[model samples]
Target: MFQVYLIDDEIWALISLEKLIPWKEYGFCICGKSNSAKKAWDDICKNPPDVVITDIRMPGMTGLELLKRLHDSKMKTQVVLVSGFAEFQYAQEAIKHGAFEYLLKQVKREQLKECMIRLFTFLSEQKKKMLETEAYSEKQFWTQMQDQQIKRAAECLFQIEKQEWIGKVCFVASCKKENIVDKKNGKMIQVESFRLFLLGERDENAYGLCIADQEKSSKSEEIKKFLAQVSEQETVWGISRIGDGTQKVSEMIWEAQTALRAAYFSQNQILSYHIKGNGWKKWDELSRAMYYKQNTQVRMQLEALKNEVEVGAVLSDELFSILERIDYEYKKSHGKNLKPQEWIRECDMIHSYPSDKEFFRWLMVFFPVQSEVGSDSAQYIIHLIENQLANAPTLATIGKELGMSQGALTQILKRQTGKNYSELLLEQRMKRAKELLVYTNKTITEIAEETGYTDLFYFSKTFKKNNGISPNEYRKEKRIENEQSTNEK
Candidate 1:
């Protein structure tokens, strides 16, 4: 039921309104009645009602002044103005001040009831819209945090100013499809397949911001019982340390994810940051080994890292960073080019794995060694071509260098790398051109010449055909991405 407050300077007017209006039948309860606007204002501040009805003219503080105060306070209260005078200016002012309705002093019961119904409907719709917008903003904020777009995430949080969310501990729970109840003041936000819960205060197991001292122990027991009721076979949770402010939301989320990964690895029902260890140093070592193509060292480091996780170490974002570095190194080492979309799909596949061991196994195949005869032969031929790339070696020059006929070399290349000599040469040249475009501020003509292409137009055509974007367009996109990344940092 909605609460309503009535205020007027005239005692008779207040009594008449209370006696005549069937507030209870219309889904409203008279919360407070005051003869002075000042008293009403004080009472509203103490306990704001859902709707307020007041006479326009009052001593000390007029109804307009009270409306302005309520608007400034940002309370979700609907206001209706009742006045003795039916002047156009008074009604216009009431509307300007956001009054729900302006009614004449001697209003008929039927007219008053109709206005009340309309106001109730309007409030209901407004409440729904506000909730939807808040939910959307909350979801967007968390997405931005995950993407490392800190500024954008902060802006989203600022828009949805929930003071309780500040300085709260964040928790993330991954579970099969099941309904989770909000027993505390904490709120649950759905993110893809996970539910993120922000706990402002904790009493043992109870997760909420508002709890009386006397009820703390009972609340904690209640929360523990609730968690015990959940099926451990299908649920895992990660809890973050207390957050400082909105700015630290991203950091807190990362911590929560780290804890969650640890829980998954250890097969625990719940994990907290206390169990998190420094695993990024090992991740960095693994990345460097992969970059230098130290196969033995990479394998050793990966095995050690896996052992560490099995014991208790939590996985960090550096895990994904290592995968990205491996992808870059794989392309550079093998002379294979993959589109960004393909790279993203590979990352998503890795992220879907439930444990570190499974992810490592996938990575082994993802960056396979060139041990097969076909792959080794392809790499050898590519190496020979790269050694004399400036000469723009033709099929005959390449075959002669390798002591084979052009026909034999063409068939071998096609069978191994799925591309003939001419296609491979073009692809190599385009890849070099792209590197020059991104790593060096060289003119298109100079880059084309460096890549063994004398004709700029032909070079551009081949680049566009191979990469689906022209050289200049690719450079511009890379620069924009770099700038955005810098700003995010």
Candidate 2:
């Protein structure tokens, strides 16, 4: 609703206007009323209204004077002037002051209503245009501001000249699930908030931030309070405490990100603060051993494994070998016993995966791993079944072991594997029967019993479906092949 301010020196006239006009119907509400222009101007300045209806002449300040004041102040209030005396000079002055609608006090109610309607329409159109322009400008401004924030953050870290003044640097924390406040204006956006924050001093610069919105706290208190609140929020954060300005802020950013990575393995969900220690101060002693390190080669091998996974190629031992070498070099360089076995296990898991999508999903559950492959329900179900098939006597039993009802598993297996439980079982058993037929001197009845089919004729039918020949025919062919191989040898 449009807010309105009513001003008239005559108390009865103000009362009459208040009663006669259907203010709500015209999308208006008389937020305030005043007996003099001075008082009205004060009210308007404090809480400006959309429209102002005022008498043309008043004792302290005339309507013309009020209009001039509003114009000078750049208030975009729509004005309507009401006067008893219809002087030409007053009408000319009203027009000059951009009065929306001029009216005589003795005018008929119908005429006044018509004027009010026209004014309302005109004001409505102007409001709409203004809102559209504001929305458009807001979008553009926000986009540019975000870009500037990223650039400034990068400069604060990487640009060496900017680092000399910085006393300490901080990395603001965010989450994938939470909303991100705009770095510049703190405006809320709908996008998923995942941003890296960089704040540091330039040469000889120090700024303080309070934990709350009150007066700024001391630097130490600010850091402590910030860390305390972050802990209470149960939100994880990777932070670098006060450090020398000699090291680049960008390096701190990278370290902070690395800290977050390490934190991902913990259950705290809030690794609130971490500060890096000396970078091998025993440099000459460590540098002598560093020559034997294979850091570059290890990183390259990891990249190759990542590339193979990205393209949905089968995982190779080459990737595992690289991880092992990296593990070895890391142990030697840091003089900390790094677990090559852990890397070996992780590599085995990745390499043993049948497809990239499964590997990627497993990675997402533990660590962030990207595979440019989409999921297929059929392939996934088959893989799942294949993994669990060793524990059950039949496909139905396997489905039950996997927490699915027999019917649902049956339908899913049919849709995904293109074979119903019975058919799949028959195929598996038929292969077992063939192995018995060639490798062991088992009778047809014995073979049938061993393959989980008590009925010989039914077993033969299933054998034909799988091998394109009956059990006896398959056995005969195998015997002939075996005899020929024996003679050749």
- Cα lDDT of all candidates, in order? 0.63, 0.54
Clashes of each: 0, 5
TM-score of model number 2: 0.33
- Name the regions of candidate 2 deviating beyond 4 angstroms: 149-489
Identify the runs in model 1 with alpha carbons over 4 angstroms from their true place. 72-75, 148-489
TM-score for candidate 1, residues paired by index: 0.33
Q: List the residue pairs that clash in candidate 2.
A: 157-250, 165-202, 165-203, 165-204, 166-201
Candidate 1's residue-wise lDDT over 132-187, tens digit each?
69656755655564565444333444455443444433333233233234434235
Which RMSD values do the candidates have, in order? 27.8, 31.5
Q: What is the lDDT of candidate 2?
A: 0.54
- Candidate 2 local lDDT, 1-489, one digit each (tens): 577888899999888877777765555667789889998898899999888988988899998888878877889998888899989999898888778878888656787678777867777787668766865674554346436654564454345334333343433333322322233533211111111333322222211111121223225445444544423355444443334344434444434443333333332343333432332133333234344543333333434445543432312232243334544555666554333122323334444453444543432221111121123433444433333332214555444434456786667767667887656655556666788898888898877765666578987887898779988888889999999999999
- Reference-based lDDT, residue 250, model 1: 44
Error of 1 at 154 (Å): 23
- The 10-residue segment of model 2 with minimum total lDDT is 365-374
